[model samples]
Target: MARNKYDIDEALDSEFNIKHLKRLGTYISPFRKDMAITILLMLTSSALGMLVPIFFMKIIDDFIPNKNIAGIVGVCFLLLVINIINMINLRLKVNITAKLGQNIIHQIRSDIFTHLQELPFSYYDDRPHGKIQVRVVNYVNSLSDLLSNGIVNTITDLFSLFFIVGFMLSIDIRLTGICMIGLPVLMALIFFIKRKQRVAWQIQSNKSSNLNAYIAESINGIRVTQSFVRERENIQIFNNLSKSYSTSWMNAVRYNFMLWPAIDNIATLTTAAIYVLGVSWITNGVAGITTGVLIAFTSYIGRFWAPINTLASFYNSLLTAMSYLERIFETIDEEVTVKDNEGATEMPPIVGDVEFRDVTFSYEDGVPILNGVSFHVKPGETYAIVGPTGAGKSTIINLISRFYNLDSGELFIDGIDINSVTIKSLRKQMGVMLQDSFIFSGTIMDNIRYGNMEASNEEVVAAAKTVCAHDFIMGLENGYDTEVNERGSRLSAGQRQLISFARALLADPKILILDEATSSIDTETEILLQEGLAKLLAGRTSFIIAHRLSTIKNSDKIMYVDGGQIIELGNHDELMALEGKYYDLYMSQYDFLR
Candidate 1:
């Protein structure tokens, strides 16, 4: 649970257009076989329906006039048979598209989540976490039906419109011309609403993202809010986001609902004109426009408009999906700034030796976190980094782990450039214990096993024991099997750190990074942890960032970092003897305590 960088009211642009259709088509490509089958079935169903009106015309003109009872009964049976086939086709289409829709949703969401895992920390630092979650969950779900049913339905409807119009013209060209008078009106209405409706829906989507982001941030910071008695302020912020969403939603829906009524009215007027004109020609005894032909022609008019109405709904769904897909693609398209280079190989066994030559890096351009800073640690040595707030102490550990590529420089492990190896292989051999140690919701044993998935239960317990966590864990009612919620609410902050320390230890890494990992532990617990760690990491290379004097006093070297450079470096006594930055920092703490 972490708060976002910006306010919830932050506005977003509506970039929804036809461009995302190409990316969406790629997802649909894998299931083209199912789509082909669905299309064939739907067209067959439409063809079957089209035959019914013609059969009725035969009964009206020939069967009933001659008192041919068998012909009328046979036509009824044939229509019934046609309807049963259409029903069967409808059922099969539903089955295929249902599975198709879910599979596509699964694949798209999996791709988005996988890309998120590969994204650098800087990508996350720039956006709200909830925004990313929405793309995977909400945005993908909203487009599922559109990708499946809406697509196939629109295709069949377009083909159906063609067949109906062709039949109408065959009956009587004059009557067909009258029926088509509404086509331009329907097209004009759709064109006029297209951009406005898409923009409205896009606004609604942004508001929804904002509301969800704020809700997630509020839940994470509930303790802080309650501590400061700011419940009323949070409620006000939520209400404002919700109101914006509601307004945009109403506007989009108003435009959406407008299409149906306008289309229905146009169809109604056109059908009336067809009835009047067709009957007038038949009554006048015009050639090729008999009573049977007039009846069949009017039926085709209904069939023609039916698909037109449905096509409008499909257009609405497609536009809605376009707005959502824009956000989803934005996340999927984010660059992986720290990925491996071409021909990168798996990192060979990491030795303790590490070096950074003329390294320069930054979180933001023109604002260096570490500039031209260089350091080297010998095998089996411990080095501590000490610095003021905003100094580059944490950046050193981050660079060691290769979380971000250096803006300009070379970082080597055991004399081999780190950029020459696969990121997974590089990180696998290291253990990092950060200040904010996240404990997922599960049994304590499960949490520890996460560090080493292949570790036996005995190994997990041994690591816990080495970190002085076994005593407290065994003291719990269920021992190591006790369930803990996320952030380890059941355990104290110090206990959580002990469990995290045990997790990191279980990795058995050659290079260990502890970034303020002991800050939460009590004096007594810290002392016990230090005793265990001294023996455990004796032969390993370890980097410890600590403010507590006792924690780093025995390090082989200590560096005082400030203004993006290591201003002072030496062993503890040697640095204190120089009366430099390290001495002043240590003496200040010493004075504060005394």
Candidate 2:
């Protein structure tokens, strides 16, 4: 069994880029009408909010000084109306943006899943399941705020800043000049902090993926851990992963918290400067400077910093979200390595003739698993492949199914190159059963019906009966309806294999490939399985990979393979007469049986 290793030191080169936003915009484009309405509402709300400080300024400079009761009452009423409208706009904007954000997330997640299905098997061979799951679930979820509040609030804050600045400069350019001193410094500080925060957040995100991968791998192999009495070691490993994740998160938090104090200190110092300079200017007999103007200047300054604080928060969030965005787009941009050629046609129903011509394959460069191998099988032929472990028996079946593209040469079915046909059409007519015998979490009926979704209940039971699985299934508490837990942990290995056999048989495939299909079965069950398999193999072309010599004795032809090359090809009696490699292997097993 291959162990899943979690490598935390892997380098992720996910620099923030504008093109990521452009690609993300495609998902958002579908809801452009709703987003437009949201933008309009946000603008209206910010415009109304900016007017409130002006109302206060007016009451101090005009209504209070004139002692006009009607003016005060009228201004208060107008302020109330503007505030009510602002509240309404804010509520509507939240509704629109929230729904639009969720919809965009749905579209993005759907696209990622669809793309994952199209990706070749080779892509998955190099990645961990948990890491991919994190991208689909956790990473995509991290974008919720960026799509909702980030876009809306950033726009609102920018407009509010523009309006607040215009109002402040109109009141007193001198006071505004004092307030403006900190603006450049604050912006520069934000820019500097953003760079550090981005790196911290990227590290944190990577740590999160590492943690998820570790947990998933540990849980999947909990049985092995317990079997070896290594639970303590596993727990220690988990603790290490958790500690690293927490440390990275705290580092990011430390950098993020730095932003708030920096912005606040600048705002505070600017306010203090305004008060000191304004008092000095007024007391020194400056012309056209009054108490009301001074009061309004303070009010404008308060309004000014509020948006700055909001923008600061938004910037921090964008930095964090950019890390997730980079990861998500990275997965989305992965190429589908195995795809039909241009103008490829749908494969017609197979007559079960498979041929490999000068096939060469390798998982990596310069390490060939299959080197220039060629063979042909006619329709309804039972071809058994007997090989030592790692002799490329399974690779032959994987190539026939088009799971991975060949590095060179051609594989054909009924004279049509497998690569030249649509993958779905080519794979639909083939049934494969591997040694692992994986069973999903579902009732026995559903598991069997998976091979043919349109198969009726009676047809499923019939397939089960044909595989000698009906007897054991009926003995269960709920018969076909009995629930199988995850990976069929509730069932024995032989039972899972039988269920998988039933699934493959239900498909009624034209070509069947059994890679150690009966490895888990006992002698008694094997006898019954062979009886049913004889009937099943009557008219279909089949390939069987087996280590047990007894299983392939009755096969029409047995090809003995070793070191990626065929050493002998004949029926059992003919190979025994030759006394070659196959004869020695058979006699060893024969003596072991005796």
Candidate 3:
């Protein structure tokens, strides 16, 4: 089982503030009835467990030496029945607790996924995908262990200790006191061991997170690694990380080894002292104490020490489990910065007009990407934006889609401020095709239908044909049913681009944004796609950002962007007449094309 990074530390935290357990209690509220039943079964199983030792004591004191055959048989039968009952109850308890653990894990996983969806892109921008995956998957699994086995073992251990100690005291207070003499020292040693190893455990946890991150990144970028021939270098780096993790783990283990033996020795000495005292008392004949009672007391002493030992060691497991809870809570506590306004209503159907008025925006505070930038595209008009790299063209497109909120701006679609409308409705009105397109590992039909999941098979094919994607798709071995493995790696770049076009067409968006959509296609395919593009661009307000200036020369307007500002805006002929930024860019590109 993969342990979560948080388990080690959070579990340790529980020792200090057990009240934090209330949080977990609240999380389990929905299944309280099931939990209650599981706890009941656990308590019953614990009772049955304690009964076995008492039964043995009875057999030893009453039936064994007397050779009472009927008494022996009855006791044996009772022991066998109790054993069977204990095993049955234990099985039921484990199964129910296991199910409860799974249900809680499922709920947590689902909540994490839903939260990810609600989170804005900014949250992902600064975080590693591997780290997120670790928290969601590995962490949840560890939490499952903590919730089921951790809880069950802890409750049973406490109950067993209470009953066992109470019974031993009832038999003889002096022996009981002597047997427990070593516990304070053992507990102190446990506290010392935990304190000393905690930092090492924390270091190990951190290294493990790094190791997981490294593996996740390396696997995902294996192509990059192989292409660059960095296999040996990566292996060395991983080895270094593994060594660090091993060293930290070993340090903690060393402390554990030293601490346990020391505790065992102390407990052993205490037991020896008890035996010596008992022998001296029996020899003196002060109080009438039988050899049988002393023998039974000796057995009880062994049982007591073992559970105490187990309970002492259990602190580590408890600490680790609490650590996992901390990490889980940390993730759950993360705030989604962007959310819908209260009582927000969905916008009406779009008529394709879009306007950005005095929009100023920045990803981080004060580092503006777009400043006082404004533009408008009339209904059914196609506007092309020609810009150098980092000229905020994509930023403008993102703004229109409200993928980000502007610092100070009023972006309107069909004359209503975009923020005033529901984000879902606003996004539903736009279609986007980027240079790098995504295709899932599924049938071509399924990939296309992703744009409109409810679209019929006939509709999917019709949409593909509309974008001139049908010929290439049908030419494949399985036609529309052919699987595209791993982001369409089985297909060519142009093929993926075509599928993307088909998807956008299926969406039938009112506003279209194409960011270097034809940049990766061959000249022949690009020329063919231009015909389809003309049809797709009709009846929609379209914004095209491209370095291929000739492709959008016939667009209603051309905007030349430089240094985060629109330097020129006019028709093709008008820009050529000006001989400004747009003219220079076109002339420079003309030399290469020619």
For model 1, the run of ten residues with the poorest summed lDDT: 1-10
Error of model 2, residue 254, in angstroms:
2.4
lDDT of 3 at 385: 91
Which portions of model 3 show Cα errors greater than 4 Å? 1-20, 193-199, 252-263, 286-288, 305-314
Candidate 1 has an lDDT of 0.88
Flag regions of model 1 displaced more than 4 Å: 1-19
TM-score of 3: 0.91
Tell me how candidate 2 scores on lDDT. Answer: 0.86
Per-residue lDDT tens digits of candidate 1, residues 412-521?
99998999999999899999998788899999999998889999999999999999999999999999899999889888988999899999999999999998978888
Please give the range of 10 consecutive residues that has the lowest summed lDDT in model 3.
Answer: 1-10
Tens digit of lDDT per residue, candidate 2, span 123-161? 888777888889899999989988887877777788878
Error of 3 at 245 (Å): 3.0
Better of 2 and 3 by TM-score: 2
Model 2 vs. true fold: TM = 0.95
Cα TM-score per model: 0.95, 0.95, 0.91
